[model samples]
Target: MTNALTITDVRKTYKNGTEALKGVSFGVRGGEMLALLGANGAGKTTLIGILCGLVTKTGGSAEVFGVDIDAHPEQTRSMIGVVPQEFNFNIFERVGDIVIDAAGYYGIPRSVAAPRTETILKRLGLWDKRDAVGRTLSGGMKRRLLIARALVHEPKLLLLDEPSAGVDVELRRGMWEFVVDLNAHGTTIILTTHYLEEAERLCKRVVILKRGVVVQEGEIAELVRASGAKNLEDFYLRV
Candidate 1:
């Protein structure tokens, strides 16, 4: 089967000689949930930013489905969705409006985006708060709102950055279920997270990065066995 996302010899370096990604390469197949694990400054976010077209790469190539991201950015992005680590919505805007506007940015008409917004908000348990200002919602709600905004256009690939960070355990688990359901329905998911346990449970494959280089990549179970470690945390430490 063809991959939903692909990267080849990707590299990124800042002007001050800071290397965020060093010759990274990977591919994520359709219907797969791949976990990108790394410590701080390990280039995980930089890699994700490049894939989402938020950051320009210094070298190498990336493709979504079969379309080159650099050569056909708009076409590639139309088939991709991203939920960033930080909230980037207007504070005073109504929750529904925020999602609707985001969908519009993707070239989705209001008539089409409105129903999707309503369904996503309701599914993520944010429907009741739809009319509330963004600032008035709780942290978890805000996170869900961001996710809902990302899904408003129904992209084929979804990139989630630290989906469970700072949220309560219950809410975290709920988000996992939501993600799993989305994947079961055939959306390719690529997640960058610090929570090894969550990655172990939710991702079939895992990639570990250290100092902007890929140190490990394999099926989660295979990686754990090969490292002679009982869990992902232990394997990560050994790396």
Candidate 2:
């Protein structure tokens, strides 16, 4: 099967002498959930930024659905959706408008974007909050709104960063179920999260990064076995 995303020897170095990524490489197949595990500043966000065309790599190449990001940024980015760790929407804007505006960024027509936004918001339990201003929503609601906005474009690949952060357990579980449903419907997912058990349960494959270097990558079970660890948390620590 063709990969939804491919990174080959990707490298990034900052002006301050910080190497955010060092020869990192990976492939994410369609309909698969790949968990990128790492401690704070392990380069997870940097890698995601590069993939989303928000950050330029110092070296190497990354492609989304066969389109090279550096060579065809607009084309590559159009194929992907990103739910960032930080809220990027105007806080005073209505939730519905925020989603619709995001869809427009991808050149989606209002007619096409509206229905999709409605469906996603309703599915994520945010339909009633559609008219509410972004600042009026709680943190969890904002997070769900972000995810819904990302889906408005019907991207083939979804990138989530710490999606469960600040969410209640029940809401987090609901988010997981929603993600599973999305993947079942053929959306490829790449997520970075501090929650190991969530990753263990939801992702078939895992990548462990330490100080900007990929230390391990493979099936979750294989990684657990190889590390002789009871779970992803233990495996991560061991690595």
Candidate 3:
């Protein structure tokens, strides 16, 4: 089967002499849930940025499904959905309006966006809060809203940047179930997260990055066994 996403010796460096990704590479399979693990400044975000076209890479190449990321940016973007680490919606806007407007930007008409928005919001447990402004929702609700906004357009690949960060355990587990269902339905997901347990639970494959380079990449179980370790945390430390 063709990979959902592929990167070949990807590299990124800023004008200020900061190297974000140093010749790193990996590929995610179609319908797979993969974990991208790293510490702060591990180039996880930069790599995501490069994939999303938010940041440009200085060297190498990447593709979504079979489309070249750089050569067909618009086509590549249309195939991907990104949930950033931060809440990016307008604070004062009604929750439903935010999602509807996003769909409109994607060229989805209001008639089509309406019911999709309703279904997505309800599925994520945000329907009751639709009339409320974004600022009024709790942190977990905000995170669900973020996921809802991302899924409103129904892209093929989803990049979630710490979707459970700052959330309570109950809500975090709920989010996990939702993500699992998403993957089960064939949306290929690549997640960047600090929570090792979450990664261990949800991902079949893992990639470890350190100092802008890929230090390890393999099946989670294989990586743990190869490191002579008990678990992902231990294997990650060895990386």
* lDDT, candidate 1, 1-239, per-residue tens: 88998889899998899999999988889889999999989998898899888999999999899899999999988898899999889999999999999999999899999898989998999999999999999999999998998899998999999978888999998899999999999999999888898899999999888998888888999989987899988988899
Per-residue accuracy of model 2 over 155-213 as CA lDDT, tens digit each: 99999999999999999999999999999999999989999999999999998888888
Provide the global lDDT of candidate 1 against the true structure: 0.91
Against the true structure, what is each candidate's TM-score?
Answer: 0.98, 0.98, 0.98
Which regions in candidate 2 have their CA more than 4 angstroms from the true location? none
lDDT of 3 by residue, 1-239 (tens): 88999999999999999999999989999999999999999999999999988998999999999899988998999889999999999999999999999999888999999999999999999999999999999999999999999999998999999889999999999899999999999999999988998899999999999989999999999878877999998889877
Instruction: Quote the positional error of residue 49 for candidate 2 in Å.
Output: 0.4
Candidate 3 regions exceeding 4 Å error are: none
C-alpha lDDT of residue 121 in model 2: 94
Q: Report lDDT (CA) for all predictions.
A: 0.91, 0.92, 0.94
* lDDT rank order: 3, 2, 1
Q: Quote the positional error of residue 150 for candidate 3 in Å.
A: 0.6
Q: Which ten residues in a row have the lowest lDDT in candidate 2?
A: 223-232
Off by over 4 Å in 1: none
- Superior candidate under lDDT, 1 versus 2: 2
